[model samples]
Each structure stands twice: as C-alpha cells, then as structure tokens.
Target: MEPGVPDDSENLSDSDIRLETVIQQARLAAGIDGQNYRRRFGSTLETDFGSALLRCEEEGLLEAIPGGAGWRPTSRGFRLNNRIGLLLLEHRSSGPDMDRSNAHGMAES
Candidate 1:
C-alpha cells in the first residue's frame, strides 16, 4: 500500500472519496469546490463534490456558511463525520472486510 493512502482505496465509493475531499477542503478554506481542489483534481471532481454537498445538505449534515460559497458541517454532520472517519479507517486497515458498492456504477479517479 502507498503510505497513508487507504489500502482498499479502489473499493472506496465515489461518495466516500468526495465527502472526504470536501471535509479536507473545508479544513483548509471552508468550501466544497475550492480553487486548489479544482486545479489538482480537475473539473470532473466537481460533479462529485456537488452531488456530495447536495446529499449532505439534504441529510441535514451540511449547510452553507451563511453568505459564503462554502459549506460547514452542521452539528449532525459533525457527529456523522466521526462515524464516517471511523468506517473509512476500518476499511483502510482491514482491507475489504465489507463489500462496498458504487451506486454510480462507474469508477472515477
């Protein structure tokens, strides 16, 4: 495995990767589609970010940062974020202990 890279990365759902990226980006700035993310990951990643953001928003897990074109986790989002982080860690460390299905049915880099 590539150090720090999830061992079962190939098996990770696009939603998982997208949400992770958004969370990481939010830490750096406070948004889902920051310039750096767009530059490094390309526009294709934006679609994933959009869908992920919408899903979280719908789930009451994320909300816009007042007047900014950014998002922040709601209290509910924060609680679920920890659960997600742990699930991801479990997948990474255990290496395919559970089956993960991609609803999109298409693999994205």
Candidate 2:
C-alpha cells in the first residue's frame, strides 16, 4: 500500500460506515443537524463516529458551521469519500484477507 494508506482488510465497522453515510447524506442535503444525524445512525452524537466527523472537518474534508451547528462536506471531502467507497469496494472484492500489498503496488515502489 501507499506508505500511509490503510489496508483493505482494515475495514471500517458498521458504525463507522454509518457515520460516513451520514456525512455523505449531509453533504447531499447541503448540511446536517448533529441530532438528526445521531438519530438516523442509531448512536449518540458524542461517540467516536461523531468525533471522526469533527476530525474530518479539521482535516478539511468537511466544514462545520459555527455555534455548535451543523456541517457540510467540502469539495475535498466529497472527493475523498468517493475514493474511500471505491477502496472499500475493492477490499470487498478481494475477500476478507484483502491482498493490500498487491492492491497498493507496494512491491513496485
């Protein structure tokens, strides 16, 4: 894999996937309320998933409104999530073990 890239076998849990889905949905919907997202995802908004979304915002993947408000995905965030989806798909296709070395061409460089 690329030096820092996570292996496909390192799959996100259902909760994580749900969080990502919520983020994407929020993006599609323009913005999303934290409470509403929490409800939809069947988890508290203060858990690791919520924290991850905040981290995404800090990393420029999304933008959070002020006053503890809602969030919107940035162009970069949208693109990243798309890429993540593809990677996940590839991982699934490769089976649970997921040959990351081949998938990432780590042997080439």
Candidate 3:
C-alpha cells in the first residue's frame, strides 16, 4: 500500500476483475459491442462501469471509437492486466498475516 499505489483490494473488486476478464475476452474473441457489454456486465452504458471505461480510455488501456458501439483494449491494458496478475500472485504467495508495524516505525525516522 504505497502512497500512490492503491490497495489492491480497494481498487479492484471480484466483480471488477470478472468484468475486466469479460471485457478482455470480448475484445479478443469477437469484440464487445455496447449491447453485449451491458448484457455481460449487468449494467448500463452510462453508469460506474461507464466511468471505468472512460478512465481506462484515459489511461490508454482502452479506446472508444467515434460512432462505435463499444470500446477496445489497447496494448497497454493487456500488459497492465498481466502485470497486475503477477503482483496478485506475489501477494498471495507472501500471505496476508505479515506484520508491518516494525517497518512503519522504521519509516517514521
């Protein structure tokens, strides 16, 4: 939980990961159209998911084509997802019972 790095649990939920996977699959398989995206995500195109889409676009993770129905993931998004998976794997291997009080105290100096 570095200052700028969001706590993994806070930034991504199970649903968010599932949605990301679905979006990635759609992009790879047949590409996601607005209708398909909405149906798959169980939400509208103008909600929080919509905001996420926009954020992803801004982050260069995805793109929204003018007059197109759905968005597409950029190369960066694909790479980012892979990196995130690796980080999660590392965190899992380290386990969650790690005590950080000593580390925090040292940092205070």
lDDT against the true structure, per candidate, is 0.49, 0.51, 0.48
For each candidate in turn, the TM-score is 0.43, 0.44, 0.43
lDDT (Cα, 0-100) at 4 in candidate 3: 88
lDDT of 3 by residue, 80-100 (tens): 755433433444345442332
Which candidate do you rate higher for lDDT, 1 or 2?
2
Off by over 4 Å in 3: 1-21, 24-30, 39-43, 82-109
Tell me, by lDDT, which candidate is best.
Answer: 2
Model 3 CA RMSD to the hidden true structure, in angstroms: 17.7
Q: Which residue window of length 10 is worst by lDDT in model 2?
A: 100-109
Q: Is candidate 2 or candidate 3 better by TM-score?
A: 2
lDDT of 2 by residue, 57-95 (tens): 566766665544456667886767664344434433444
RMSD of each: 9.9, 16.4, 17.7
